[model samples]
Target: MSNEPDRAWWKEASVYQVYPRSFNDSDGDGIGDLQGIRNRVDYFDELGVDVVWLCPVYDSPNVDMGYDIRDYRSVMDEMGTMGDWEGLLDDVHDRGMKLVMDLVVNHTSDEHEWFQQSRDPDGEKDDWYIWREGDPDEPPNNWISLFGGPAWTYDEGREAWYLHLFDEKQPDLNWENPDVREAIYDMMNFWLEKGIDGFRMDAISCISKPHGLPDADTGEDWFDMDLYFNGPRIHEFMQEMAAETYENYDVMLIGETPGADPEEAKKYYDDGVDMVVHFDHMDVTYGPGGKWSPDYVGMETLASAGDDALDEMLNTMDLADLQEAIRYWDEGVGDEWNCLYMGSHDQTRAVSRFGDAHDYHRESATLVATFLLTQRATPFLYQGDEIGMTNADWDREDIRDVEARGQVDILMEEHDVPYETIAPFVRNRSRDNARTPMQWDDSEHAGFTDGDPWIQVNDDYERINAERAMADPDSIFHYYRRLLDLRSESEVLVYGDTEYVLPDETYPNVWAHRRTLGDEAVLVVLNWQDEPRDVSGVEGVESPVLFGNYEQRDGTTLQPYEARICDLG
Candidate 1:
């Protein structure tokens, strides 16, 4: 709210993700293009999402969306002409919103010119990829690719196995090679120089793989090192990258380090790496005894996760560790936190996984929002999440994520299960559960497209689209807009010290966290259940309801799933 701007712009700003292939299609090609993103830059500016994290539109074979990089410099042939990319950058900046690109340096598609040449044993660029000879009957070490089977794939021409942490076609780059690192930094600098703001690093934490190819302890033909997740020299290399590629420019690094151990996880923000898409806290929300557990539905009425579950989940897992993750970065190397919500292209929709999206969605969504926005980091809002988007109707053939499809098939085959038993599991676990096109309207294709979509749109789009939410004051979209507005206007929500309160007699389903900045205190209270509740923490001076899904009198009873930000007394 102050006239003075940007002590930490990324921290204060709201980020909206653009999955380019599905965002909006301009050429009637069924896939969304960069121009589609260009068309929506103004929409983002008006919607109050200050940052735009664009999913890869880079030239690729489209094996894993756009993650399999073929050429880092060229825009995808499907996305648009290079002229469209230039115009797209101009449009984003003209709207006063920041643009972020996906940095996927772990591997490149087989078709990439580098990989093609690297496969030739006699070629000068042969050392660019990790390739080694295999014993006649055996394989090249006992290393399995993170994707599924063996990490090393035999190349017919070279008669040697090449390291590929993912799909065999996308060979891992040997970053130890100075030329490779220089190429990556130069590619980043190329984009940064092209007026792009920054990047959202894909599998960034996996960049510094342990040089000595190590084997997994699982006693299988697989190699996975504790070091691979967070290698010894990662910080050094990343800092070097920041200095060479992103140092001079105003860029934000949002890292996605999946399934990282707590120790290695903190390394993300070390060396001034900005915000990390960490999942330590998120794992707490999973079901060792959640609804899917056979015992859960049988239990008459479940105890609120706010009370019983909080104590159980947080007892072993540190509530303060989240703050610790961010603080470790602040104290060690100076950098900010990246705030986030429950959904991404890789994550299931918040409503689908966290709570019953059908009935108690308001309460569940508000509880998650309060937790995400009120925390000390910067916040990124997934597309259609503001309107409380849920997963597509649960099924198997409908799935889209390549990883989930292959893994689920393997799981089902091992269990000797019928498709019925496996379908729901895949539905719950698949990334495609989140990648369904943005729910824009109640029209055919949810107003996302006039043509057929690459992925199925959620059936409830008629009821859950943006048009309906934007019109209704109580809609989740309106609540998010209000929250984004409040975040834009208040420093307390952005960087305040948090104080959690144990729920007691008054509000049974509420999870309250007090955020304080010196004398100013902000109380964000969320109703996490489908029942009415009352709370008693606002015991100070003339209190005002700063924001809420429902309009409540000073002492009015809060309905199920109500959310409110009240001024501290």
Candidate 2:
């Protein structure tokens, strides 16, 4: 009898994340709606993606861009009605693709009915949110919000303080309250019953809070993550939630865990999450002081900030750090599954961040695609990434992301930091870089809308739109489609065990790895930098080149930003 682990659909699936506001604008209102998604259903099919992970389109105040949910069951008016969402779900299903909704139950908009009712201190829903009694001037604790300012907000009507880990308008739910958990489960079931595939739970690790909600013991500059993250009853809450909702249906549950390491990530699987979106690889460049620190932007001090700071950068995503993180999770998960990604709605463009966008745009983007698809995990391709989208060139006045604005506000208000000093770093690392409208064509507004767009389209749309890419066989879009097709046909690539080769110290700019399944092995060689490298010394480097980004095959030297998948039988 075979001892191989049981096969699951999610383990073998590849996901495509769609940011609704920027995916496609159908109403010409400049914002993408459900109908717009329905219009592009054929695109998902053409790309051969197995799952479409839709970002939150629920009723929201647009604070934090729909992360703060006002109504769980109602679809936002701008995104269209419930009928539009149902049509989208059906369209996706008809194409043999699954649809996963973004679950943002960690917090709700202050305008939520539950929060509104909770304001009446004597009401039954008073404890629905994390409310505490304290002096008006001083909060119950000294916890700092992840966005900016104190974590607590004064509620004049209730004469109490409420906790908001993100924007002040987004109040954290009291998961400790059984009633709150029940309500969330009911909401999940409602969506599941409607035939949706699964959920991508947002800020899921922050669902449970530590007892007493203590203040920070570690200095003043901190989000107090240690106090609130991976809380005491996190496992219990997750297990309960799963048993009550997802376990009843054939659905997958993926969690967004920010600070979790490999061992910590394993617990989520036990807590009923099929897999977790780990930050090990993503947060590699974030300094010890966190994302906004000067070290993250390659600056030792803001005093030396100048117009050429970006060109004189010292810090960037380290290959060694990325390798270590990827290898750790790849091995740490054991027989369990993993979610592989290099870009997301909250991150900068993959080609710009990890590849040489200015020098080897096509080579680097296709190389990055090769890296993700050839891994031993279910890969998630972010919207526009397949078309080799680059980050936006936003100036200080063009910044639209709330996270960037909040960080800027904090730095200026508390530390008296000048806007000019932080503008370059913000422009490079802002989430808005990934939120730009999808470039469908080279027409006006890049064919995204007839009216004004919600966010500015990347200025390079004329050269990098999908229409141009599809017409070219050698474009990044076609490369992605080929990789997806190859991945679907090869079980070895999906179920193979990974082995890292060429130690980071010896080959710092090259990523050489082997995926082996029984006697079949595929060697994936990636030249991560924009310079030719001698890869002849690597094991199995002479094997048959099953696939590669370059037209000419070099047995000894790998071209700049080149990638190859070699079959070694």
Whole-model Cα lDDT per candidate? 0.70, 0.87
Candidate 2 weakest lDDT stretch, 10 residues: 306-315
Which number leads on TM-score? 2
Off by over 4 Å in 2: 1-5, 219-221, 296-315, 413-418
Each candidate's TM vs. the true structure? 0.87, 0.96
Candidate 2 lDDT tens digits, 1-569: 02253578998899999999998989899998899989999998988899999999999999888888999999999999999999998899888999999999889999999999999999999999999998999999988888867899999999999999888999999999999999999999999999999999998989888898887886745666677689899989999998899897888789998767778888998888898998878777666766776644543355566534462352366788888988999888887789999899998888877777777899999999999999988899999999999876666677888889887776666566677766666756789989999999999999999899988999999999999998999999999999999998887788887889954666888998998777778999999887899977798988989889998977879999999999998
| Model 1, global lDDT | 0.70
Residue pairs with backbone atoms closer than 3 Å in model 2 (clashes): none
* Candidate 1 per-residue lDDT over residues 73-118, each given as its tens digit: 8988889988998888787787788888888988888889998898
RMSD in angstroms, candidate 2?
2.0
For candidate 2, what is the total of clashing residue pairs?
0
What C-alpha lDDT, on a 0 to 100 scale, does residue 77 get in candidate 1? Answer: 89
